[model samples]
Target: MKWTHSRLFLAIVALIGIVTFANLLQSFYRPYLPTITSLSTTNRSDVHENISHEDSASRISSGQGVKNKNLDICENPYLQPGYVWYSNTTEETNTTWVPFYPSLLDESYSSTTLETTGEPVDPYTSDGDPYFPTEQPPQELLDVSPHPWMQDIVRHYKLYNSSLALKQGGSSSRSREVLEREELENRLHWLRNRRILIVSDSVDRYQSEYICNRLGLELINSNKGRQTASWCHIPMWNLTLMNWHIASVSPTKPAWWWIQSMQIVNVEERWTEYYLPTLNDTIGMNGKSPDLILFHTGLWDHTYFIRAPEAIGGKASWARSLNWRELRFYMQRVRMVITMLREQFGDDVPIMCRSVTLKKSLPSNVSILNLDRAARFVCNELDIEIMEFGEIIRGYFEFYKDMVHIDRGPLSVLWANMVFWYLFRTQGGVEVRGDLIEMPSNGTEIVNVAKEWNTCHGDFMNAKRY
Candidate 1:
């Protein structure tokens, strides 16, 4: 009886050992199982599809889960053309130029009236000019020189060490070397001659203005008073001719010219009466006939409450209920504008959209639920290419002064570099660098005095000389 009991106890111990061993193996191999969820899986796909279809407000409120790993939704084999991934890193490294054969070339070259007027008058007239003229000069005629200040600016912005900033004596040779390394001179020269338009809200106006000033292009604001009826003409012997109309305000006429408009609207205002009509008007007129339309409108919409006027009391309520439904309606309006632009401009016109910028801290009555999730849902539904501004600015938060605006120094340099990199990738134009010119960093020292007036205070009485 004692021997039988011992054998049974040994069998029970063996079973326990097997169970322990199995658990250890399971824990060891758990990490080796797929860390990323496959989008092809039935469960994940269904969830994503539902999230994508939800109203922007509902998505904002619910804060749906987004698989960060599967950002490249347009990567499928049957993807449409002109779906660009706009990133400074990717543009600098991964982009390759493909010769774009103009679809209307055969039709355009055959027309005589169009050539003379610099406009498409008739589609059928045959002219002596070759159909689909090429504008880029032969590789030999192209100048591949870098701007003198290109290196200094790049170093100041990119080189993190303050010691380098102070110790590094500004050298023309060093500037030349930097420019040569990045091929900035040639790139700038090409860009100077290309017609490009920048349309943005107040936040991006400084960058856009700086770029225009640096490149010798006119800057026009969308605000009514700032509008100017000026046309920018680029003279190139090869088939390259571009015209620019930079306006902060929506254009009065349909943009029939080869215009590339950058649309950056403030999304924060209430959509019921004031902001919606303005947006609709802008979209109706300027959204069509764009060669490349870059859309960015997410920052202002989140983090703030939009309160309707109370019927009984005059005072604004702190616990004012938000009109999220109205917000989603405007978002859908934006989507419609995108669709119309795609239809009018054709699918090949590159549409680059931007995600909302991140705030350092959350606002009162606002949670993370209202911002990023809404942006992701709208982007998914619209089928637009997203430039992940939040992710890009994560490491470089110091570049920003406040919640939204960036410092002028870093902002200008960053925009210039981005534009340079983008133009390089898009095969738009080479950099144009003329004689080396140096100006004061700040415009404080002006030799000639314009009438000194404090516009904010409306005081022109005091005139002091520096």
Candidate 2:
């Protein structure tokens, strides 16, 4: 109460020092301050209460709400360290588990949904797409033999079963049959109630035949009659593979014209009576449309009209090369087939167009163009997937005989196994395995003799995988 000059001077000096310290503190924290205009002190409490309520409601809706008095709400966001508000965000218990992808929620990012169909995303699923020859192979002497995996497969079954048969007092044929059945069962189980329909020419039929043998189905004799369409069933596997033959989806000329032009005419004449009927009956055999339909045809069309040296089934009979008009019509017919399948299946089935199996075949305009049309019209339009099988097998054309048919012996097994691996990794959602068989040198050309196969069966005992 007693005023003194010295005491007043000291008080004034202390006040000046305190003000300087406050200014220094403010300048140090200025960079971290939020740019928003500061709220009045009267409304700041209400704002904090509102944010706490909003966060509480979000947590409750996300099923993570539990009162935790120790948890502090974001009150002074600007003063707090980075992402402190994110700590306030509660983790939800109800969100369905998804594969941890950093950019999964980004709008510009998209991916195939095959792995997310309530199935675990395994290594093969996350791995890159399957490899195939998409270009004409250079003249490199690649070993055209059974893939190493295929040889291992042959050894595992043939030798092991033969030795087991000797010990059990059973014939080697009995051992072969047992192992064949077991392999079939394994393939069927891997398929997991899926069906495949392969529509192609004689070359692809060889593939079907190989698959049938693996499953122990009897091969139909061709000399008796070339079965335009046939199927074999494995009841335990609940799987059916149907091989349907078609030279071209769209013929260059009228039915009468095709009939008169060449001995091996385009089979468009049989569209209604033969092709469509077989497809209608064969597919949906197991109370469901085929999971996959592989369409392969360009080789037959190219050979039939182009007078290529390796004309399918013999030499080309055509006197002149087919003009663009004919080629366009052929493409139209192929496009029509894709449209027809989409209309029939209603986006439930995945259709793939196999590119022409020929050396330097990437530029085979017919196959590439038709496949593009399919992807656009059927896959994109129908909101489904129409794959290109050629992408996976295009690289192995060297292993193919005549650059058309997959070489029967071990090469055929390789090709078939490639297809199986693709289906298993991409669609089957199961462990990958193959149903392979060692074929005779004649390859898949001739109708396999069942009686002979049941007997010695083409050096099966003498042939070593190594």
Candidate 3:
């Protein structure tokens, strides 16, 4: 109990060192707060480390002066590191999604219930907000979840599923896994039980599988698909992906739904009538619509509907996929499809039209550019959003698993992130724009806050990330 003067001095020095190290750790994880703020909602979370270090976007990247200036929680909610905490309960119908992000629990927004209320912070049962575009991509080819929290999802999933992570680790790893499980489980509770509808060819079917797998769930009960509409459901997560097989927005032949005998009469017009009821039976009617709807139809159309430029029925001679007449018709059909979906799902759910994905061969490629143009045109006109997967992987034939589907890798993750981005936009009441996320071509987009410590932003980023 008797301490010497030298002992006391050493103790004080040690205390200062510990405090400095802790502060350094905090800065390493979250460099700055609120690069941009959400303009729509009021109850921004004060829970997690808020990071909005966005001045890098305007500054352009160089070796020098990687300066950063960020906004606070009052401005943009979707900026990095800062996320809203949501409460989830076992009662499926009781959860409240973030419709708008106003501010960091601003005094003006007492009506908001998603934030903390002096109770134990059981986010799984608290009202929560939908968040997204969480992934900021890079030039690297094999990207995973684009945001830090989402990266946690992948880390937890891979580690949990791996043989080493599951079987080899001892009590230390087990304890770590237990803590991680609780954290990730509470964080991802908002996305579970949310049904996502994908109406396209097999590519989206793979995409659905990726989304489920990324979330540590798997799609099961698959039927004879890859040609017709088939689905796989994960009841544990209450997540369902429905893929309706339509080659064209306009009717050309029988659709590839489970019902092999789809009538060809006005098929495009009638697609939704059948699709919705069938989806109702699958995901349930209950007046509850899917949380997100993604659709793109063209590969089948090119192969079956669009006539050959040189020969009316000759598929080989068709040098082009879009003529003025066909383009007009394509736009009309897309509009009809979107209109039908809007009427059925109501305005709450997000409806996104995926662009026509690229194929490897030139014959198949001839029409994709045109097809994409037409799809984008109609989607833009109708206020229906577009997911430009095609544009992202354009000309990268090696990324294709086959002639159509994109292989599993960064491309796949990007696809899921696009879906997440659109979902948040719709749920958050944010205006949908294609170029909202900062996509720098120089491989400098920073999901990890530390990487940006020295990276320049803004006009300095390349025209396209490699």
Candidate 4:
């Protein structure tokens, strides 16, 4: 009986040992299997979503929607294969000579009377640069008559008083007092509940924050960074998921898969080569879309002077124009990316392109000629709106701290005003009370006629202007 009992005890011990071994295997393998499974699923989803979202977003953003067919007045000629060839040459011929506001131009006092001999010369020609004027005209010609559009542009130009214009204009219409009252009442109701998304690169952050503060809305950074809480009067949101850690060059091969898999944490490096890929990642990670997507990212590319090869179907002539090549390349990249975004987001997205701020004391080499040209091209082609900060910055260089970044003093006001203008235009709102100025009835005709006359006369007419 004792022997049988000992055998039973041994059997029981064996069974217990087997059960413990099975439990150990399950514990060790279960955690790893699910992790691997989840990762696989996520990666597949990301790939699928990236393609789908990008495709949809591009179509939507480009104003290709059925509803937009009626509303989209901006023609997109760049979509054609040979569109650039025609547009570039055609625009050069059809150049319009829009005059600058006399208030904005430098006025010099001279005791001698200036007289013209040949003809009413084109004021824009002899200047070398189209936008800038070379010789100051007599105060008589300066005050001759304000063009209709010129007057409006000048008035908007003066409303640069930072927060006040935006704050007052937010609820009112600049054109009519009755409309302003009605709009103000409606805006108050709307302000009670509405969320907006402001997307921008580092340069835009300052502007975005300032505008948000004025509106009593939160300013969020899409890029990963922290601004002092005290810096803003109102709360701001930051959507930046990663901080950049710029390397001299991009990884030669695909590294995102490995980086994401390991859950590696690092700053986002703004390498010239990595800009597109990084943008791709950012757009992918934007789990939900925002109301507005303001974009600005030409600075890094401008500094790097990176170019794709002609074999890749890039402009070979660009290699020769090294002077403006980087800027051109930057614009080309922007055009491609923006085109892609428009396709995905649709026309209702309200994309606004803020022209790059010029450095104080304009670089003898780098002028806004290329920047402005590129901006005008993109805005016209894409039917996207642009905030002409370049002109404003050029006029007021004192607001800048360095070549690129703006100083905190008046720069803040400048940026705030720009944001205000963008919002005002998009929300169907009007300009500030004192911002509207009347334009001459014949202003457009005069500018157009002057430009046409110059085209026929060529350099002969250009010489007369000098």
| Predicted candidate 4 versus true structure: per-residue lDDT over 307-421, tens digit per residue | 3333355532322323555556546666765665565554445565666665443442153445456655765576655555544445455455566666544445434444433
- Model 2: pairs clashing at backbone N, Cα or C within 3 Å: 132-392, 133-394, 133-395, 136-360
Name the candidate that leads on lDDT.
3
Query: Could you tell me every candidate's TM-score relative to the true structure?
Result: 0.38, 0.44, 0.56, 0.39
TM-score order of candidates, top first: 3, 2, 4, 1
How much lDDT does each candidate structure score? 0.35, 0.43, 0.50, 0.36
- At residue 365, candidate 4 shows an lDDT of 19
Query: Which is superior by lDDT, 1 or 3?
Result: 3
Off by over 4 Å in 1: 1-183, 187-199, 213-218, 226-291, 300-305, 309-327, 359-361, 364-371, 394-398, 401-403, 428-466
Model 1 Cα lDDT, one tens digit per residue, 1-466? 9999999999999999999999999989974554333333333323334323222233223322221222221111101121112233312221112111112133322332233435343577555433444233222111112222333333333432333453476533444444453543232333332222223333455555554444344544324223221122222201111111222112122232112242322222222222233332222112433223445544433322232233333443433334577456545755654565456456544454544455554442242234445545675665554434333444444556675565545434534444433323222211212112222122112211011101101111111111
The predicted structure with the larger TM-score, 2 or 3, is 3
- lDDT score, residue 244, model 3? 67
Better of 3 and 4 by lDDT: 3
Model 3 scores a C-alpha lDDT of 0.50
Mark the 10 consecutive residues where model 1 has the least summed lDDT: 448-457
Which scores higher on TM-score, 1 or 3? 3
lDDT value, residue 410 of candidate 4:
42
